[model samples]
Target chain A: MCRAISLSPNSVLYAIGSRSFEKASRFMLENGFSPETKVYESYEEVLDDPYVDAVYVPLPTTLHVRWAVLAAGKRKHVLLEKPAALNLSELDTILEVCESNGVQFMDATMWMHHPRTAEMRALLSDGQRFGQLKAIHSCFTYKADDDFLCNNIRVKPDLDGLGALGDIGWYCIQAILWAADYDLPQTVTSWHEPELNQAGVILSCGSSLYWKDGRIATFYCSFLTNLTMDLSVLGTKGNLHIHDFAVPFRENVASYYSASQFRVPIMSEHSVANDRPQEALMVGEFASLVVEIEGNGSKPEKKWPEISRKTQKVLDAVRASIEKGFQAVQIVS
Target chain B: MCRAISLSPNSVLYAIGSRSFEKASRFMLENGFSPETKVYESYEEVLDDPYVDAVYVPLPTTLHVRWAVLAAGKRKHVLLEKPAALNLSELDTILEVCESNGVQFMDATMWMHHPRTAEMRALLSDGQRFGQLKAIHSCFTYKADDDFLCNNIRVKPDLDGLGALGDIGWYCIQAILWAADYDLPQTVTSWHEPELNQAGVILSCGSSLYWKDGRIATFYCSFLTNLTMDLSVLGTKGNLHIHDFAVPFRENVASYYSASQFRVPIMSEHSVANDRPQEALMVGEFASLVVEIEGNGSKPEKKWPEISRKTQKVLDAVRASIEKGFQAVQIVS
Candidate 1:
């Protein structure tokens, strides 16, 4: 909802496509969209729209690669929902298609654009404050909706990538990776509840990721939990905690105390208006890219296949750990 | 010094054994003790004191069981420092000597006596407040002394029990066990950093304990960390957090938070005072046992050995997990 509102000013809603055109038109009209915005009964009709410069694909997880590829082949930039594809093969196919057609492709992982994340990264790197980073702990959990069990794409393994790990675990993985400055995990292990579903998709997962420098990162993600989102980074000198990295409006800060006499800071909400920005910033970056392409012909933005490949590898190892009952998987890289 | 002063009214300080007895005596005198307290030439003389009703054995960890057995033979109640003994065999020997001679043997694990602990426990068990207890998380850690490499007992495997597990990890283990009403842990796993003389002792440990009724408790304890002592218990209705369990004088309190609101009562300093009460209460309990032994010829204190044995079994499994590099160790009843 926030993304649509943010992008509406610069980008026209070319056409609203759903299973029913009447419902799509109603949604568009209710959101203050123009009446000229065409209504398409099928996704194919929207793909056929020559004026459509980009496609925001929010379909079920299983159809992401199919629609992304179709949109890219039609010379349209594509922004796909998380767990970009069901597996490595599908993600690779989408990447190949987008590259061959010279169209931009990006997984809409808004957490990466959060400004507080950038601040945390800078804080960890600053020797005076954090010193050498040693470990990271992260958790993202919330209760599943009632409809989650009724043919929901999130519960389908072939569609939703790998259950909880794909839905919320991906954010935790990305947080740890970015905080550690993209250090490749040396090994990974995971544990999950077994009674959830037939796809053996993990509903809850706890994973340990080892880095080459002997640093460790642990994360937990669950769909059967009372909502919680937290992150902690431990270093030699001090530590930083983000109670809710998803919406970091205020955070509690503490440093290592060295003296007996110290003043207690009044408990006040420390607001960083620009501290942690959300994925909506990506729309602005995307807008800049559009302007760059439309105004002056410049070199294209750098593609991130390496990051995608590494992320998929970690995801695969985490899933393997869950299948084997949290057995440790030695990461070759 | 606080522990020593508590015993002064009834027991004579026959000897002070240290690299410098004068310095030790000065420390005692500064804390409101008489300078006439005997300064001993050796620790053996203190153990040899016939007038002593109890032996306050706070010697380096390796000497705990040796002195404890010697004191038990001399017919003195033994107040031994924690990590009761290095292994099960030594603990058995200490217990056997005390039992045969009819002397009281106690481990100085005092956090359980804090009043706030009882308050927190009551709040958690109240069906209207927190409902059924589901999970527990705890941590206890502090910075190592500068000369820890050369002089610290914690670095020596024989003295410090294992490493962090024996030194500080025991506190967390005891906390979890107490919160669950002494339920036996069904499984355990741990991770250790052995380079810092942490052999058989985990620097960082994460374990999941499954009770018979499907309740799960998880904990983390580390020695290679800044000072922190906190516990959070999740229940069906709400959660209770006992912040700073180890240091009650330092603004520690019990907090209860439900889905909609939270409450934190200002705790009086004496509410959780640690000084004298732990030893005084335990001694009072033993005094009652002494009366029962003399009058009814019954041995109610016999349950202490059983509890100690159970604690030892869990400790052994945690050590095994560290040796196997965090492999899960199932506890067999």
Candidate 2:
């Protein structure tokens, strides 16, 4: 995030804070933050700085509600990392505060801001190329080393409680929603036998989502499998396949295949050669939204918050499904 | 099947049969069959021909038990097209007769005979490269035209019976089984709300399979979506991804990607330079087994029959899960 802000034209590494002053200073120095960037001893001090326009929260899932609300209370726009609050109610509280604060709020899903994202979206939405979508499957998995598995915050119940579901499943769910144009599924059913750590944090799981029109989406997320980001969107006329949906091949290189006639793999010809990296673009996008409200006195865009809320709602439903022994949980608005 | 037999070294298009003599003659004419090929009006005449050592049964699921049983009874080895039968009982009946007659039995799942299949199997089985199999997702889908959807034999409950599940889902289920090294799942649960034709035949459906050790697999098969054959086998160390698992790009071309340590895609460098197409290889394989039985008095191979039975067992479990309101159906046997 610090590097992204440093590279973002609309944003800057204005202030950073940690529990330890030395750690904050070290982080700033190591990340090449300018000498002018302020390093605060405590998080509240960062929010207390009246000159700060927006704050990016990279705290664990458990701390999102508290710090996000506090940051919003300080009238600072919030750019929060994903698994934004553990559940929908907590997210709603933070979003409500941000709404009342008249500050922009967006989750830091960097891939959303990538040029390839919009290019893929355009192809998916094209009637001639994709037609009506019938089904979607997105999976994001990576092998977590023993050290990380045993000690990572993701496996701690009170920290990144949702574990792999929150860490990588967030991308799978978001990709599905993005493909479906954010129409929430009518019901969510977690597939049976999700593996959980000793603390009961999910290590791996899968689910099936059903819409009213028979359009379905399935996703699997795991911390135990090799890194795999496979997103396949099936339409009536063609299908879009992305092998590296979560992380691009290189920092800036990404490509996909569109197989319309089943056997024939049509590699997408045009590569997205964007100069700015995705993280920088994401920070730029969030900061520009903040600028709209800050300089133009415009309202915070409702779209981002709505998307976050829908994703949270579905996550909550999945949690409920798992809790209820893998039954289908209806998603009531 | 006729074409495959013609290309096989041990097999020949010795006899052709249809309901009408002219239809059989025209088929032989169109396919460039030798004038020595006997055109029979009745299927029984071809089976009755003592010179014919094997029979390829491409009949619909409804006729599988009848034709395959009759063929086996006449001491002709049976190469049945898949969804081997409508139900396990039917498949079992066919298998029993084939065993009694000492005739080799094999399902014509062409991809299994492809050299790429064995190459991928070798890769998946490698402990260092793939580790223990963790999860798998396979989907085989294709769009059925309007006329075909309404008039096709597959849509009729009395004909293909299982519809899309029997036709395409067979490939998906078999692929999942293959990736798991033919270990049947402890339980199977069908995903919710399958689209059904007016005759109550499945047009699209999905299911989850679970092993006792927490290995899981899911598959979706559809007749409503554009042609999509995606098979992803994820293990701890690396993952194998095949975009066209069911049908290759062309007759004899196929490839896969293995992305180990997450983002690094390691495509297998050496492509299998097999000269024969998958279907021809399938017939050649089946015919060679029959030759061993005929020339050397070898007993019918049990491996092919067992694989067909396991696939049928899972299919039956999936069907039961759906019938029981998507409940988890235990595979007791």
TM-score of chain B of each: 0.79, 0.97
* Alpha carbon deviation, residue A141, candidate 1 (Å): 2.1
| C-alpha lDDT score of every prediction, in listed order | 0.63, 0.89
**Cα lDDT for residue B209, candidate 1:** 57
lDDT per residue (tens digit) for residues B1-333 in model 1:
344335534434545655577787777787765666666656667667665566667776678778889888987777677777777778889999989988777676655545666666776677765656655666665546468745677767666756777777677777787777677877775543322442533455555555644355555555555454556555544454443565443433333223201323211122343345444544545445555654576654766565565666777777787677777888887
Q: Write the per-residue lDDT of candidate 2 for residues B1-333, one digit (tens) a residue.
A: 778787889898888879999888898889888999999999999999999999888988999999999999999999999999999999999999999999999998999989989989998988888888999999998899999899998899999989999999999999998998889899999999899998899999999999988899999999999888889999998888887788776676677777666344633334565688889999999999999999999999999999999999999999999999999999965
Candidate 1 lDDT over residue span A132-201, tens digit each: 6666767665556568855677787777747878887877887787778777787886643322566666
Query: Backbone clashes in each candidate structure, one number apiece?
Result: 4, 0
Candidate 2 ranges beyond 4 A from true positions: A261-270, B262-270
Compute the interface RMSD for each candidate structure.
Answer: 6.1, 1.8
Least accurate 10 contiguous residues by lDDT in model 1 chain B = B260-269
DockQ values, each candidate: 0.21, 0.74
Indicate the residue-level lDDT of B54 in model 2: 92
Q: What lDDT does candidate 1 reach at residue A235?
A: 63
* Ten-residue stretch with the least lDDT total in model 2 chain B: B262-271
